[model samples]
Target: MIQRPRGTRDLLPPESRLWQAVEQTARAVFGAFGADEVRTPAFEPTELFVRSVGETTDIVHKEMYTFEDRKGRSLTLRPEGTAGVARAWIENRLHDRSHPLRLYYIGPMFRYERMQAGRYRQFSQIGLELLGADSPLADAELLLVLHELFTRLGFDDLQVHLNNLGDPEDRPRYQQLVRETLAASREALCSDCQRRLDENPLRVLDCKVPSCQVIVADVPPVSTVASEASRAHVVAVEDQLDRLGVPFVRNPRLVRGLDYYLRTVFEVVSPKLGTNAVLCGGGRYDRLISDLGGPAVPGSGFAIGEDRLVDLLPDGFKVRVLGLRRLYLVPLGGAARAEALRLARDWTRAGVVLEVELTGRSLKAALKRADKEGFAAVAILGDDELAAGTVAIRELATSSQEVMSPAEVPAWWAGRS
Candidate 1:
């Protein structure tokens, strides 16, 4: 049968509790924003994504998964998570410690693309980075930790957008007004915007090809090349997200392909995610550590994809794993089935989840298979409660039975429910 592979799948039991309740509420909102976990390395050095996600981005020209390494080198398979957390802050000098170095990460991120509905070609991401500061409260603490992790994951209608992409002397005059407005319609666009109209003219205004969004719908808005010191760093990141009441949306053709971003940029959209793209995106790279050779320390980060957030949650959700209960021991044959398998292995060594009917089922079919596996009580030990040294405790959702005493059925199944 040999199956399961193409774009992966297979997380069964209770659908992995929507990835452990959105990865334990995104690790308790990355420990309430103090950020700490950092584990980068699922392959790299494919020129670190053509030098920090550029080479005209389509996640590095036509979806990366790259190869080469049996010594030849190239290597890839990383497709995002801030260039391996900025190549582990420049090969671990972690800028010799101190000053905004907060961090975070949650795995899996290959990208060959083309899978739909919450997209996945081996996908999953959950990120947050904030290295050193350049204030504006580090872009309002990344829009207040993605607005408190989409309001603690219930995600009721979101949308934070906001953009600036300025600085680095105003992104080369907004990439020369998007290459003189896509060179007067580079032969009517889309051939991947005519090879990205000279490698990334704001990714041809993020084309989604409705005839290249009806030919860049009158082109213009790269905030007409901003720069009054990048318009006061976009009004100091929207006056600190309007002095922290935080709700945003400037959009204006938000570019973000990462050549170490300069001015603020963000995204957190979701009108219940069936459309408006991003569920989390981040910004403010501030010259990604002196353009990846370290020494220029400013940063910002965000990522989230817990496998398309378990198809955007809200179905039967379960994570309450505190079960442990079986204690069957129903011996009715051959020397009380060897003393019901030695008192079901000594009531599972004084603990609990013990079982016996090794396929001889009869105490009402082993208490109906311990009330279909959700057993919160079942300690019979038949042969007439092993001739009264006691052992009954049935409950199984109150079918009520209690006889007790085989050393008080491990303190009566620890005072059950």
Candidate 2:
């Protein structure tokens, strides 16, 4: 038998229900915020990521799955959602529609990398982007939306780690400060950090190596070298969050891996993961549009790792979505079996989740299967019930049975609901 590739998964029954519930929640929440869905290709020209996500970032440098087409043109599966959305914003001329476009996307992203728990080579991301807006209020609004999403998901202990990456002008100075500070400990740094120090020093702060983190701990905070304007920008964002009751912490070391992010960058970490897994990460990328050969448009958004989010979903939500009360119709004789479809359709149309048993199984065997599958109730139709135009509904939990007319089944199910 052929096996699925490593770092990939098949979302099977019940669990697939959880994923659907999460996506449905995202749609309702985002739609309430005046955001419409947008979809781009799963893959695009390789340069799209190289230009937008940054050359030195892990996504562009190591993770992306790039291949040449028949024409020998390079195309890559997207590793993140924002860059593709930015490309779409420009190429489709969406920027001309309104002052700021509120958009959301739910899709798969591909990356070739070492897999770990809650991380995958093939993953799904739910992203929201606010384009053409540069106000501090816009940044606050994005965070607010995230807070609302988490609250709706029943996440009680998620932390929003915020930091100032500063404007483009302040980058050279901050990078110089980072390099100068880590110079003495360069030899002790990991090979990745050492290379990052020269190529892009900010990436060094994002290093996960224990030793590299120790050396990077001594580096000065980027805010020290950040411009007064950028500092004030983040301050206003914090103020807005405070007033809005969106809890967050100013992590001097917080930095996103992408190159386009500047001014405001953040990660939402879940304490339930024990390892502080980041379920969502995003920030302000004001220059991304211009960098992608489009008019300069400021954008702010974040992408939630749907795989990780579902893994840590609260028990309350799981029970509510997965514990659906369904009716299993067991038709015992040939006539009753033939009538099963009509009964099932009527109950289903009445908003009752009903399943008709078509296989030739005895009433005892069907009841066993229904109990095993966690059905709340079973409707039994035999020759006697078919002749009397009645059905027997048995509640699995209580093992109690009730005889009712076929037309009364809907009301009975509604009362049970």
Candidate 3:
């Protein structure tokens, strides 16, 4: 038998229900924030990410799934959501209509990375972008939205790690400091860190190698070199978060992996996930829109990994599936089966989930199947019941039977607890 490719998953029942819950919750939360939903293609011209995410970032340099189309255009599956959203906003000229276009997206993203627990080569992300806003409140609001989502989803013990990468002007000075500092210990640093020191020195602060971590620990903090304006912006964001009752920690070394981030950066971490503790990471990308061919626009956003978020859900927490009520239709005779089919459509439209017997199963067999499959109730139809213009509905839980007119079945099911 052929197996599914690695790092991807087929969502079956119950698990799919859980995914639906997450999507629905995101829709509700983002909608409340006036964020309209936006969707972009799963893939785009490779240059889009290269330009927006920065050439030196891990997502663009190592993780992207780049390939040539038949026309030989270098296209790549999106490894993250922000770049695509930014591209769409520019191409569509959304900035022309609104000062701040609040957009949210939930979809699959592809990467060519080693899979581990809660990490996949193919993963899903739920994110929102507030374009055209430079206010520190916009940055703080993004954090608040994430905190609300996690709380609504029953998550506790979440720690928000906050930092200021400073504006573009402040970053160069800090990068020079980091580069010079890392160069002094080049022999002790990992090969990756040494390479990053030249390509993107700030990434050296994010290195995870034990030896590099030791070296990075001694480096001057980004805040040390932050300009007065950048420092004030961060203080404003912190004050707003405090006003909103959102608790956070200031981590000077918490520069995000993406190079687009500037001024304010943050990660929401949970100890529950062990070493890969970051559940969400995002920050202000004030220049991303212009870098990707649009006019200068300030944007702040964050993305929560659906895999990690769902994995942290309470054990055995089953989502309430939304749809028609669960009621099976068991027909004993040919005429009853025909009538059942007609009634099935009407009942479905009226908000009653009906499963008609298609395999010519006897009433006893159909009832047995319904019971095993966990239907809330079953409707028994036979020649006698059809002639009387009534159907016998059995409440599966109590095995209690009651006769009701076909037209009243929907109302009866609706009234069921």
Could you tell me how far off, in angstroms, the CA of residue 206 lies in candidate 3 after the best superposition?
2.1
Q: Order the numbered candidates by lDDT, best leading.
A: 2, 3, 1
Alpha-carbon deviation at 102 in model 3, angstroms: 0.6
What ranges in model 1 sit over 4 Å off?
Answer: 1-13, 25-98, 101-116, 119-126, 133-172, 186-205, 210-260, 263-284, 287-297, 307-378, 381-417
lDDT, model 2: 0.92
Specify the poorest-scoring 10-residue window by lDDT in model 2: 270-279
Candidate 3 residue runs with Cα over 4 Å from true position: 315-325
Could you tell me which residue pairs clash in candidate 3? none
Q: Per-residue alpha-carbon lDDT of model 2 for 249-344, expressed as tens digits?
A: 999999998888999999999877765468899999999999889998899999999999999999999999989999999999899988999888
Clash pairs detected, candidate 2: none
lDDT of 1 by residue, 152-243 (tens): 66665677888777777776777778788768778988788888777767777777767887778777776677776766877788888888
Query: Residue 244 of model 3: what lDDT?
Result: 94
Clashes of 3: 0
Minimal lDDT window, size 10, model 1: 315-324
The parts of candidate 2 lying over 4 Å away from their true place are: none
TM-score of each: 0.34, 0.98, 0.93
lDDT of each: 0.75, 0.92, 0.87
